[model samples]
Target: MYGAITAVKDLALTVRQGEFLTILGPSGSGKTTALMLLAGFISPSEGDILIGGRSVAAVPSYRRDQGIVFQSYALFPHLTVRRNLEFPLEMRGIKASERANRVDRILKRVHLKDFGGRMPSQLSGGQQQRVALARALIADPPVLLLDEPLGALDRNLREQMQGEIKSLHKEFGITTVCVTHDQEEALTLSDRIVVMRGGVIEQVDTPEALYDRPATLFAANFLGEANLLEETGSDVQAERSRPFGMVAIIRPERLRISTRGAPRSPDADQRQSVIGMVTDTVYAGAQRKYHVQAGTRMLTVREHVASGQQVYSPGDQVRLEWLRSDVRFVTP
Candidate 1:
């Protein structure tokens, strides 16, 4: 019951009462389908979804106590923001006075108290999103399911909303599950990130663990940019091969650049250094990214350029060195 095309596969994930878990994957990776199953929008073809140690596979969609916010604002066009926020409570038969009190509290929490009388079309994109969030939070459900809720906002607004959502989560300690393809959003917002590939869970860990010691090549490359260097039999014989089997994963920031023609240190290990020519350079506000051609592989390195220091240009020959401890071994 996930996605447009259903492919039945077993997936097991557990969420604590107030944990902020993010389900991260590319499109068609079954992340949205997973969320849909938990929200009771779609039932699994097989297997059960449990809540509070009880199986909820048979629970009806309307009966499940879950709050959902989608990528689109999904607000009613004719209804004012106040009415939109009250719809969920109205469905639950809450008293008008109680609903109004809850709605006002949430409207202020989302910073849309003044915009409550305005229509969804009358507000900015960010403000509309805040109203949608208020609508979801009005019910105070135990589980909050968000499907790319910030995807519609611009870059600056998206960042601002991310912080707002994080602060709200901390304030209320509500259990949340967010699905997104954006890696940076997952890293910044999630207490634990669940990486998915080909409709299955690839790895689950903290942001630092996923970035620093990815369990697989897919995990390493998916979380961020990683340069994979193949090691031949001769390279293995030369002690350049990693322990995982076939390739070594090096993070861009872990690489160190040294001027060519310098004497090698007597204690330097040959496997930890490579001679390469800088083929391209891209200036990032805080750091510069250099594309270095080493043998048949191209490696990316990020270096911070001080205000007064000279910057490296394209085609500059340099030696790339990194400590063995910085190298992550991944299976081919």
Candidate 2:
């Protein structure tokens, strides 16, 4: 409890074989603590951590057959690229010749074959990150632990590394558990995501399931941009269809925008529509976003950029429409 500061409580989860699992949460959410507990770096105050059906509560971090990559790419600055990769194998008492072969193969695999003679300080940020990943995978551990692996890279580099990491995971097929606060990164790389809040697991599910059908307000908001809406006053019961109050989640992308006074589509009768004024317009390269004021609530609507798509400007009146099924309910 850190002398009265409890980082994690009542948290439990399992990682399946040959799967990419991501632990997602904001700062101070115990995500890193959970990873440390699993890695045996920090022993659980009370409870057991099992691997292959055997509790490893007494196992030390060095004994655990897990590969770890940190945000800082913890490499020995004094060691060359090849030496850094060989450090793990050397610890396991592998012969020099065998270690050299393994390091050579891994360097080639990570496209750093020629840079083996260079030091970690001689490489770029992305290259250094690659070396760190290669070092982690060179040992061929059964489990790979990544703690904000891309938090150190720029936007373009982060995207590039995301693809590289995904490809490598496919090739290695090691059960992976990554920790990240970036929701998009989790959605991008994870087969399943574990959402945590205030030292507790909020939800665990596939990315699509978590985004499409969030069961809680925190889950709804954390995973993506959601318009939490609810009917109040007269017609609340009829429109909301819930005896108890709950918020309806509407994704910005799920909404459709049309100019005011336009004839509703044939399916409009079965869908929900609201009229609003275009308060603001945001132009992204591949898409456009509109902020519309409907009653007291401001709704966000997104439209993909297309050659013939109508672009709504600020101050223009518009109508937002979406299928009734798109409005999913979540507990407040």
Candidate 3:
């Protein structure tokens, strides 16, 4: 408790073998602290950390044999890419020939084969990121800890690197843990995600399950865009009009927007309908984001850009419908 300020509290988790696990949270959410604790950089106040059925709470960072990729890349300024990759091997006192082979293999694997001789300054941001990842994996550690490894890259580069990281995990089968505030990144790459807030684990589950059925209000809002609606003391189980009592989570993408007097009845009987007025509309290349005011609550809806699709304008009466099973319940 840093002088009575608890940075992390009541955090519990178990990572399976060769799984791509991501700890997703906002700033000061204790995500980084959890990674540090697993890496053996810091010991937890009252909990024991078990790795492969052995406790590693007392082990030092260097002795843990875990690979870590920092947000800043943490490569030596004066060292070339080759030497930087070689640092971990040199620290382990491996044979000179073995270190050379391992460095060459990883450099080639990360697609930085020819950039080894170049200084870190001579490389682009993406190249430097690849080098950092190679350095971390060159040692063949059992566990890999990535702390916002793609935060320094642009949007395009970040997306590209996400694919590469996932590919590497499949090839190496290394049990990986990544900490990031980016929701999309976590959703795209994680086999399972652990959501944190105020130093507590809010929820942990597969991305599909977590997004489709979030058990808590924090998770329902944090993972993506959500329309949280309050229930007015009615049993939602019996009435199709009433949402899941307490609070209902209607995802923007799950909502279907239809202009008044639409020709087609798409799944009419199975869907719950809400009458609202279009408040705003945002056009994008592949789809449109719409804001609808239904009963004093603003709800967002996303629809694909389809040929002959009806576009609703402000002040237009519209109906937003979704399958009865789509409205997930989020308890207070």
Across 1-332, the per-residue lDDT of candidate 1 in tens digits comes to: 43465543679888878999999988878898899889987889889998878888999878888888899989999999999999999999999999999988998889888988999999999998888888878898888899999999999999999999899889878899999999989999999999988789999998989999898888898899887755311132223455635467778998887777767766576346778888898998889999988888888999897787656678888887766667777765
Q: Mark the regions of model 3 whose C-alpha exceeds 4 Å error after superposition.
A: 231-245, 264-266
What is the overall TM-score of model 1 with all chains considered together? 0.92
Model 3: worst 10 consecutive residues (lDDT sum): 230-239
lDDT of all the models against the reference? 0.84, 0.89, 0.87
lDDT of 3: 0.87
- Residues 1-332, candidate 2, lDDT per residue (tens digit)? 56798899988898999899999999999999999998888889898999878889899999988899999999999999999999999999999999999999999998899999999889999999999999999989989999999999999999999999999999999999999999989999999999999999999999999999888889988999887555311121223465366767788999899988889999877687777889899999898989988877788888899998888988998887888778777888
- Candidate 2, residue 212: the lDDT equals 95
Model 2, residue 74: distance off in Å is 0.6
TM values, all candidates: 0.92, 0.95, 0.94
Name the better of 1 and 3 by TM-score. 3
lDDT of 3 at 7: 77
Candidate 1 off by > 4 Å: 1-8, 231-241, 244-246, 262-271
Most accurate candidate by lDDT: 2
Ranking by lDDT: 2, 3, 1
- Clash-forming residue pairs, model 3: none
Question: What's the distance in Å from true for residue 151, model 1?
Answer: 0.8
